[model samples]
Target: MKYNLIFGGIRNQDGYEENTEEVLRSFLSEEMEIPNVGDIQFQNVHRLGERSDGKERSIIARFTRFSDHERVIRAAASKLKNKPQFSIYQQYPREINERRKKLIPRMKEFKRQRRHAKLVYDKLLVYGEVYNPDAHREPPPTIPGQPLPNNDGDY
Candidate 1:
């Protein structure tokens, strides 16, 4: 089934990075190829118009379909071990175009910088560490399955 995934958040200093993008692209490529799957194209990624007080950037990712979206979000949530605030919504091609219209200026700047850096340095600093698909093996299922208390004292 076709699925759309939308996620946005304030990025850390190093987020929206080339390496991060590569990792995500590779993961998505692999994940979307399983049996009973549809295309998993990356639709859009953008930096929010406004910046935070800490000078951090906000980024958004829009996937082509819902199942694809879910798979990516599940992978992310697993990696972070938290419920993701990322969202999903079905959109017509027109709606997607409208969204990208609003996001273009910010995205254009990044693209421009990338081009400039390539001309100047011959290469840009990008995420380089390779990822092993099975690197983070799931812990064994506990027989009693005792859940731990929240150590953050939020309770």
Candidate 2:
């Protein structure tokens, strides 16, 4: 599909069979305040799964156009920052999530060195550069239960 998928953080509610399209439209129009949100068309709008840990299911949406996706992401940052019951973000497959999880260690390793590391999506960047494990070589060793060293010799 040429479209990106979004997930709406839905809280618990009774009878989850409402018109998802209308709900999404109102959310974008009123909550997100995105211009011409009605112009955005969503496909496969539905809930993710049954409730778990007393948490409500999420609504999944697939819409075309990268501009619409970016607008939603930026609007979500400002609008949903204080709304716990509401959230909007792009959804990734399980494989991608797992890959990002595995990169956590590498991310920490780079940060410990004070090299300015950040993890975005499934990739890690150190000092504004993408990290390549093979080229970077194995990080310096440290004693068990000891923290890694920084630019200085101090731990």
Candidate 3:
């Protein structure tokens, strides 16, 4: 329940197998300035998937206390704000993950088109344009015997 996901932190590929947790702990303490990292108990620190093309895999760190997780994340938001190569994210449900995955390509497309793009929850904002998949709906049909309202504001 208390966990954070880290992306693009590790760089070296040679000694990663032996230093995965150490690297993460160091990052949390040094870079993120997370207090009491050593004192805080962690459930695990592991890669999300197999390494490919010498790229480091994303890390999943589970902590024993939710406060520790929140502390790390809050520190990371300020510490890593200007650093684009590293990111810290809170764990979410599978449905949210699926929705994020669906929006990834659209975000990329916005970038490709040289427009600013940001995903806020389930909505996609591109160059100040908002796209909400669930917001679109057809208007209700009018009754056959009822007269349509005047559009010229004559009343």
lDDT of each model, Cα atoms only? Answer: 0.45, 0.72, 0.73
The sequence of per-residue lDDT tens digits that candidate 2 reaches over residues 6-122 is 555654344576777677777788777788988886666777777666665777777766777777778888887888778665576788778888888988877788878887777
Query: Candidate 2: where is the Cα deviation over 4 Å?
Result: 12-14, 104-118, 132-155
Return the TM-score for candidate 1, rounded to 2 decimals.
0.32
Question: How well is each residue in 1-155 modelled by candidate 3, as lDDT tens digits?
Answer: 33665546655445545666777778777777777778877788777776667666777888877877767767876899988778777667778878888988978887899989988766688777887655544545678887665655232
Q: Report the lDDT of model 2 for residue 110.
A: 70
Tell me the spans in candidate 3 whose CA falls farther than 4 Å from its real position: 1-4, 12-16, 51-54, 103-132, 137-155
Q: List, residue by residue over 1-155, the lDDT tens digit for candidate 1.
A: 13444334333444545443444454344432333333556566555465556553444456666566666656654443452543323333665556555444544554677732111111222233322224445644545657644545232
Candidate 2 is scored at a TM of 0.67
Q: What is the lDDT of residue 29 in candidate 3?
A: 79
Query: Which residue pairs in candidate 1 collide?
Result: 3-65, 3-66, 4-65, 4-66, 19-127
Q: Which candidate is the best by TM-score?
A: 2
> Candidate 3: deviation at residue 152, Å?
26
82 in model 2: Cα distance from truth in Å? 2.6
